[model samples]
Target: MEPLDSPAPRPLAHIPAIPIFDPLEFDRSLPSSQYTLIKTDDLRSMYREIGRVQAYLHNLINRGDDTPSLAIDDSKRAKTAAIERVPPEILSMIFEQAVPPQTDDENPRETHRLAEILLPGQICRLWREAAITTPSLWSSIYLKFSFPKNSVEKMVDIVTTCIARAKGYPLSICLWNQSDTELTQYRPIIAVLLAHSHQWDNVFIKCGGGPRKNPYEELQGAKGCLSMLRRLKVEYDEIEEGGSFDTFLISPKLRIVDLRNYGVQPWHEIGQFPLLPWRQLQQITFVGYIEDALELLRMSPILRVFKVSVVGHSVELYHVHHAFLLELSVESLVDGAASDLFGAFTLPALSSLSYAGEEFPRDAITSFVQRSNIEQSLHTFSLTLHERRDTLLIPSSNIIKCLESMPCLSQLSLHDLSKRYTDTGPFHSGDISSICERLEPRPILPKLKRFSITGPPQMSCVYLALMVKSRWRRAAGGLVWIESVEINHSRPCAHAKSSMTQIPAHIESRESGRALALLRLYRSEGLRVVGSLVDEDECIECIDEQGYGAFDPDEN
Candidate 1:
């Protein structure tokens, strides 16, 4: 059915009635005479054309007003061009001074935080390009990404950009991946980057202390990745479930290899690896091992610094068939089975030696020291007993003998790294005090520069005093002293305190009374102290938690 229209159009809500420009009446009606039409087209075309001419003149007047403003802008730009300009070389020098890249320890974890700080300062486009182009600046690369689940894409982008900027120069790559689950996912990206491993000069990879994957396979697959490698360090903890022993050997061009805390393969296989290629090898550190020294000796010809820490039950003979003109740390358990290990281990060129497990037989330590001394190149020597209590027990008198043996030692460090422990075997008390007594007749380290003693306060005090006296006697130069004393007043058997009773007698000596006063004041306060003394009498201001002491106006 068709709908019927309304009789008249209903007034629309939006429309307003003109009412002939209504003044008083709200709805004024227009007169019929005003509605008459004027036929302008029939009248004249010239008048209409004249109206167009007036509109053109109005636009020209407005454009003329804008011309002066444009001229003023041109004048301002000319003024800006008059300033001085800096050359590219000078700019590069400024950027290099402003942004220095971070180089980390043998392990990559140490430098990770530092790299983040330096990364942001390189925000300027020109500065960033300069930094990235500088091979030396970009040499140390830190690649760590396992943050959010969606970070892999961003990680790949950053790595690709860094690689492009590296421009084929040898790099120090530190890849710290914390997720084993993500490892397989990211393996392809790593393989692509590491395939350019030959571009690495000194690579240090410290995987996160989380589950790890077989990174060695990726490293091996990288074509010529280690060709330019000079030093390599791989430190992974047990937390990285997939970490393996041979991970440290990924780079064949490694000159210095440090394997710490990570799981590794058998010692025989490690020893069997050809040492002939590492002709330039100087240092090898194996902190935790399942094998003996004799087995590792197979790679000793070029070895300079060898450190191995094995448990008491697994002590094995660590002998040196060749003389090395550097440092050596070969130790075994103090049990009877360790005699052969100690006797057979001789370091003719050894300058530094540290024993951690137990004191070897007096005769064996003495013989080892005597042989080491005759070499005449020994410069630094150290002997430490790992476990001690209140008693000053000195298990290896040979330690004292070893001090006397190295007449040429320039630097000495004596340490008792052990904290309070229960007596399990033939134990002695007051070991720290006895150690101090043995160290009293300080071995004349003619070139001694640095000396540190870490243990209880009583022992540390005697040790430091004796060290000072020794230096006084020899008039050594450029001495750097470190005293790390733990203030624990819980143990009543304070032999270090009882033994220092004689200090009053020394204090009474008129020659050193002033120095004794300072020492006494420090002791009474029970404040842990560390600093250096220039002259015995002059108390040079030093730094501590209390802040640095300043020059006094009255004390000229």
Candidate 2:
């Protein structure tokens, strides 16, 4: 096997950086505000004075001072540093922006978000006061267990402190319950959070399944208290993806939901399912069959984004006409039922459509394009092609036709996940070549700006890069010249189930090298170009690893 090159550095890191007012003054955990008796003096001058002292001492220590007692004239120091001159309110805003994301950050690799806020508090009394006064600063709570286990007491304190600091403000919380710790131990932490159920605005709880009964059930008490709830995301241990909430079902302002429940077992049954305020929902992500998707569509008339993972077959076409939906994405977890959904949906307001299943429902989609004028309306389209036998799951013509139909499409991602090229045997190009060739023609997808393609082996990379190099110059004929290209090429498996990030060099050809250099040049010109050539079989994994973007329809 050819050795893989060094995995490239992060090209343009996106910090899921969405934020709001996050002041730290109000905390619910303490019996009362601990700093009430403490004077609220602006200590920025003191902070600067202290910083100078620490730096002097640090350098003195490096110079081998055993006991260097230093005296400084207080009158020699400036009253306030220039940075300290910035208003505390504005400083609060800066502090919030500087707080690392709860996840997707690797620099300091924070596991508990408590550190992001707590570290700033330790910086200076003035910054601490600024952070404390800003309630929004403490609202986005990430309650995750650190590996090797921090004491249960410590975890509980962190959770309570964050929630308490949020005061009466709505909370945006993410909880991770994946550990070997006994269920009883984690309950205290979640109990602290549940006590503030009235503040739950956006909650994401991911449970690593084991026990059927869980702290998530504690969420049941949040029903009437969930007035502030807007979004709730729950990934249950499929073994017990239980629900039938008493009050959560009736949240007045709840607008978004995302779930990873597979079976229609008890929770998914028509009557057994929780009776949520489906009418007010604006977005929903569900993983089930076409019939289940139809159920959500029936309930959420005003829904804008609907992403579904099709589980089983539903060939009996049931039509649905929805005018308010904007983005619809479908993938098959059971590998055949996805295409069935395309035949059922007719979305006129749809701006983005993505599909990854056994078949590409070409005729049905083409008809929708004609009926809804989606060719003009759609902006982002993604397709994931898999290997069935020696052939790709979706035909080349179907992909070409879909691209041809979407003239105004701006963002495009095509994944050629065919694994037939393994073992140096027959190398079926898996229609990746055809898609590349079809996209090179001008005026096809005239508005296309961003393109992403993932393929199996050497030939796919060579042809894809060549096609990109040609389309790079297509500025005429009313075509929007390509702006970004994200490529993921797979390496031959030398070890069973082998997986590791690889550098750019999969093929040593001069043509491939030139294309690679051109892509780098494009990035140097302030365009987005990222390539991930890896040993893993999963195409989506590479995209996720790049952290440049999610190859799927849009981020969840």
Candidate 3:
């Protein structure tokens, strides 16, 4: 059907016209039937002639379409095309980009979607050669040992081919076995990755986090062959009934170990867990009981970075002192429990400390600082206080004393990631006033250069202005310590749907008088300002070095 607004097609002036007898040319004395017969015969001959012309035009169009295609094929076949002249080395570099990147800390649980086709190799013969010859193209392999038989069969072939083509390059092996109760079915695929354990640079393995057969039992063959291993991450729902994941114990080059468990695997029962040469580890992330965390600290004497989640509590109490630990992050899965766990550890070499939980843990922090001998040495501190039904909003009165202890602090971030608390924020208005007074008249956190607050400050904007002015005033007088003041606030949202972000920032609005005044002050001082707000996801700064969230284990 023609569009409603479209014009009716008019005849082209240059095209042949249909032949017919004109009414004016008919003889007045002749019968109408006789005239019609003459006109019909003459029209038949004209139609036949037009058909011949139409056929010729169609033949020309077909020939015109094929000619350029034929020429392009010849040019490529004869190596006259620019693409055909590319050197093998350059082609290999281009092929690498077409391949997916290796797994990283950001996503260790990525899956086996690349099995059906190696994109670079499937394009053409030249591309296939370049991709096959480039060992790095096959180095990053994410495979699932469980499957639909046919696709698994194809994946097996692909893995075998990649292993051969990859040559001697180290492999980043990510294997996930989810629903295969009978492990023997994929023994061939398992054996293929296990054979290359000596060249393992980084490995991520995820198995049944619940009670099930031990997936790592097949990894026994790789025990002594992991000398070249550098990073290893293994996650399970819970430790199997009568099993231990000790296959990676012999790895010497292993500096980073990530053991993520979504289980109540108690400290007493964690003996069957992975036992590594802890002293050799420089960085570690563990999600377990606090007792197990302390044990790890005691074992890893030379450990530089340790991130821990206190998922379970310890029945007995003990203290661990590490002389070489530089960074310590404690994530309390239980409310009002963060500081209690900190009471059991001391790290004199600690430079950065981060704690996220329901309570502020001021007393624990003060004693911990004194016990660890970091009162004057700690340089960076981040705290996150989430409002809970069982917790109090007011931090301890000694909270002021905690900041005074950290004289060398360079960065301080306080995040009040509360969903239900609407009228208040991380500190009371009086606390904010007290803090500003300390910054102006008294001295606290003297070396603090970067101060960031997320959520409403629960104080008038006047206190914030005074605090900034005092710090910058000192800097101008040659004290020169203050750097940046980041103010992030959220307005009470109405008609917000459940699909909206957990915490919404009204970053789009700058209409408040206080906001305008602060912007003017910042501009008048000639400070570099970024007209951007930090992502809410980034406000969880206690997890990764600058962000928070649990590392989700495999759910597929």
Candidate 4:
């Protein structure tokens, strides 16, 4: 045997390589000596020597005395190639998607969106250039600050940097100041934003809980500063006796305004407030007295949408008709106040009307529809009635009369106003079935395509199927078919399961299975049926706000 410390043997260069034996005759032709030689201690020692040499070579390579392993070199090359392959345009698109979504109210210091936007720029030179040149990345600015003596200076610098980076692009600015300092603390930041008002597309300002002075008093003489402004939203915590918004009167391009007064004192009278370009305004949302809303409506000749929540009961208007108004939403008004308010306006072009409150004035709506030319022009209507102990009954005759008036109606939504999941109210299946029966005598809404019903489980699948059948025409092939039907009901409790499940179970098992059978048949023919049993703790926030708990058909 060789010495343990001796050098390992070298390969025999003189020997030619050849197979020791034919594997086909292995068992029969193999000798015992060949197996013994392979298992011997000499061969084992050679294998160990080979392993030690390989480890020593690896150590040398890692110590930077030799070239790196192929794997490491390949990874670095691949990274460089990938970065070079992506064009600037595609990189900009990816950056845009990574940008955070806009929020209505957000603290500036806590905003992670700004950090996300600035992170890519700090990664490397290539990414930094891509982020800087993308105008959309810097267009949205949210400035929220509290008084700390130095906060004003910091905010000014930040605002200036964002505007400079935005580079002539349109801006969407949201400013919120919850500081309790005097109004002067906010002047520098406000002045910086107003200096660039010509580039403002959408601006929201809310500064509350400060000194008694008005926060917007700094804009007293900044007329025509908002030359390119399109939408403005302002909410004030307090308003002095003579405070006015006359600064915005000269904004020729202003089209949308949302104003909220959260002050304890009464707002100045409509005539005493700032002058607006009423005819040019397209949409306005005001939360103030009914008289002020009426006065604004009287001056708005081409207004298309108006949403108002009234505080008083009476309204006076001299204009007999509004020619261009198409949508009107009345909220938080009593029956008498709603009637008086609706009586003052003749909306000739009104196509959609929404009323939300405890008491829905059906007679007042019917009278108004008849008086105006809405019977022929109205197409979409919604009524959300709040739950009350008095059990407000929606008269079937009134519903039928209202449906008869709107010949061009395409969509109808009926919903209970209570957003709580456990609410059960006065809506019943009989009322809906009666209205469906009225539609059967003659075609009331020939163009009606979508029907939504949301409340207690009073509406059965049978009445809903009948309503769909009445609107369907077999002979016409596919000329007329109800597009969608949505039904939302309270879930049955464990204790009351016997009562809720027994009726449907018995009918489905023994009695005529007309309801379930018809619903299945219609669904096979392209009618979408969405039935949901809501739990007391079910998530209502996930539901769509526009439709009455209806699932989007496209999602299916």
Candidate 5:
């Protein structure tokens, strides 16, 4: 009368023979006499009975099934339920975040492309459907075309699939081709991208080819096709010369442009250069001659940020003014060229200026500061000298005079390459001590808050402490407090003595201890002192204007 799945009533006689061992009691070691006693035949019979019972129970539970069907069903239902709980809109947003953060013209790694975008679709049917339906997830297509012919076809197919799935969304595309011999094979991929130029929001392309082989020739027809394009970055083999970027001139919405030439060929003449929509651009970075950069700046009236590496002498520009330019960065390989370029610009709203080269033209910098009348407005100034010869060090007087001109300056960074490997001359502790002593009495840079020095480790901690103390001393009754001081040793001090030399080591150790103690005292009063040995590569270049004035010690 009972259901087949229900357990049968236990026999009263067998209850006494059943195991009654308590788990806790069994855990302790027991004498052999205390063990349960059973004959071999009895144990075999018990095992047979247990096996029969298990089979019966299994048959009852899985009445019409065998291969874990119920478990599989339950798993499917759980997964479906969880997925159904998340609406498609929210899932799409999640997929967007899973994709790597969009970078301006940064080449996406192959691993990132697979794990973030492609792997999600392969997870399950539901995930595949979600990913396929989300246009934004597939909008960024990064293609590399250095593969063999067969692999190139496969890559093209993959790119086609991505474009199809993008579903009319604005796309961010990056194409890279490093093969020196496969120009014919990669041209098709370039063609495919140009076909969809109307949907491009950001596009970056870097390729190698001969001087006559322009990989971007297809772009000429796509001139009017770029309706939504915002950013464009192009880099080609320097040998590929004399190509015009006139197609980009029609991109009305373009705001940022970066063009890099990685070959030995010089930049095309200004007349042959791309005719960009200069007035509409907000930021421009050009690594070309001074004449070309000046010409571009002259045309870019509303440009906010400008960075250029001048390969030749500064060209004189008479009565040119940039009313809205906020930051200017110049890298002049020739000595005094940077200063000449600085004097050429009359940026009224400039707040930050960065200059780096073989020479730090103190007199030219002074003249530019006086001529531009930025002494009142300039807040951040950085100078780096890469001169290998130590014939002329940047005079402390020149630096002091510059600081005097920029009364509102808040951040100052100085990197002397000559001092990085050797401890001598103006870079020595005595000179630094004098400089700090001079700063103590001067009212220059009253609002100065952050000071950074990158060079050898020979800077006298005593002078550094004095400089910090003088700047932040409350007894002086100034509103500004020196918030951060960083001393980055780019190289090991050649003059450092080993502890095996007892007297010299002891003296050095004593001086170091005193310096650390002084720094700690300042730290207790709300100042930050950062001292560390850094690799030469970590040294921030003054010519790198990307975030020149944006260094914050608190963020570290």
Candidate 6:
């Protein structure tokens, strides 16, 4: 790597530093109401005092002991030696926990908290020795390449010293690929870090490169050494060849891998490896897909979560053979029987399921509900229909039915009810209310704490009212509402308004007994009713004017 040109240092001013309020007093008294008023003033003064003390110390350390201007202060020296008594290994562990995350706005290599960690060391010679000996504290380095001409080589040299001092504990380095020119200039340093890939446990590398038409070919260079690494992420300028990331198949220790905007490459060659060593693999996402990605998935036994999508092609899961949990996303489920995705065998441990596609078979939805242990542990269940197909195999009717089947759901998110409006017949809110009312008298979703329905405002309001009445009768807990716009306008805006106005009327004084009983149950069961509206300008204005702005959907 090329050496960075150094700049002239600025002159320092002479000033006596002061100590602010005691940390003990501030921590003890700050939380009271009476003390809150002057909290801001106290904070400002504390900041100024800290800055002054830091500046004074910087000036003192820069000048020699013989300088008359710098006086020796030994009051903090006793405390420093006492702190120094702690072992270097222990000090290193403490520093690792105290280090803050690196960001672009400040000196990336400098740990602003380092001085505080070494404050005990600053007080005496013994503490100083211990603090400097804690090599792990300096090993975690961040190189900011924004001003390459100013900071590159200096940061590298400092980092190298830290690594040498660290002995052998792996180094955690964060390098921000700021410019292509910097990348070319610092290629050797980048190669050094990449060549020692096994040492990297957490790393984020955002570099420049266009998506290759054949994604597997993109992993040709130093990227091979990254196979022993635990976490790997590759992002290219364009995402044409998502398949090329198949080169990542070499990573046997990988736990989390994110390949953005790339197509899934065939793993025919890589698949030949003994057993896919992704025992710790929990999450995997692919933005684009080729037909053979499923074959590779079958080879990976520990995968708990997956997301795969292809624009025009259909994704078929011939068998849901995974022994653990599974999550899938597809463009369309048209014509294909949903059961085909899951073999006769059901997901025994499946806890969360979300599907977004054109349409799903009602039998498949029923089979999914019937085959799984819906009565006890199904935590999250959501299905979204993208387009109006032959007919919704699972309509709002089926959804209400399926929900009735799941008794253990604590949080539920339902979306895309517009699919119920087909060319043959129109679905209505009454049908939804009737279905909800029919739900067995048991405390279905009794543990339900947070609920969200994103669709037309009318449908959401009706569902909310019906759900409240049902929950009130069963004594459910914590109701939170999140409403978002529907993709298609199946119902008119005027109709949505009329339905929302019916909400307050539904809780009328005539049925005040039920309403009061519901309120009482909510209080007793710790239920909170939170409601919101989306796509209704009038609702937002009313909320702001009426002082219920907290529920305004615009905030989301």
**Over the stretch 481-527, how does candidate 3's per-residue lDDT look in tens digits?**
47777665444321122103232232212112233244344545664
Cα error of candidate 1 at position 240, Å: 18
lDDT of all the models against the reference?
A: 0.48, 0.62, 0.64, 0.62, 0.64, 0.47
Model 5 stretches with alpha carbons more than 4 Å out: 1-140, 163-170, 177-182, 208-211, 236-244, 261-270, 314-319, 387-391, 420-427, 430-437, 475-479, 490-509, 528-556
Q: Per-residue CA lDDT of candidate 4, range 160-216, in tens?
A: 887888888777777666655465777787788778878876767777744444456
Runs in model 6 lying further than 4 Å from the true structure: 1-184, 191-199, 205-229, 235-253, 260-276, 290-293, 307-320, 326-346, 357-363, 368-377, 384-395, 401-410, 416-450, 454-466, 472-525, 528-556
How far does residue 189 in candidate 6 sit from its true spot (Å)?
A: 2.7
Q: Count of backbone clashes for each model?
A: 14, 18, 4, 0, 0, 9
Q: Residue by residue across 1-556, what tens digits does model 2's lDDT show? A: 2112213432222223223322334474334454633322334445556666666655654453354435455698768876667789997788767544433111221223666767767877787888888777788788655434457777778678777777886677887765553455566766787788878777777766555434456566566778777777776444333444445676887877876657535333543444578888888888755676787787788988887887767667578889899888878776456556666767888898888865566776777777776878999998875567645344465667767788888998987656432222122254465566556554578777898887655543444544555556436767766788887654542111232233343333323333344455445556576765323243333434544221113321
- Residue 278 CA displacement from its true place in model 3, Å: 2.0
lDDT of 2 at 359: 53
TM-score (C-alpha, index-matched) for candidate 5: 0.66
Q: Model 5 over residues 1-556: C-alpha lDDT tens digits?
A: 4333235653321433334233335466444443433343466677678766766665654563333333223445545457667776777788888655545432331212534678768877777788899887888887665568767666777778888998798888876666464567666666777788898888777776653445566567678889998888776444323446567778888888876643335444424555678889988877766666777788888988887777666455454678899888778866666766777768878899888887667677777777778888999998776756544544466667767888888888877635332223331453333355456666667888888776544445445555676677642645378889877643333212221122133343334334434455566567786755222222222212323222112211
Candidate 2 is scored at a TM of 0.62
Q: What lDDT would candidate 5 get against the real structure?
A: 0.64
Q: Lowest-lDDT window of 10 residues in candidate 2?
A: 102-111
For all predicted structures, in order, the TM-scores are 0.56, 0.62, 0.65, 0.66, 0.66, 0.47
Global fold similarity of model 3 (TM-score): 0.65
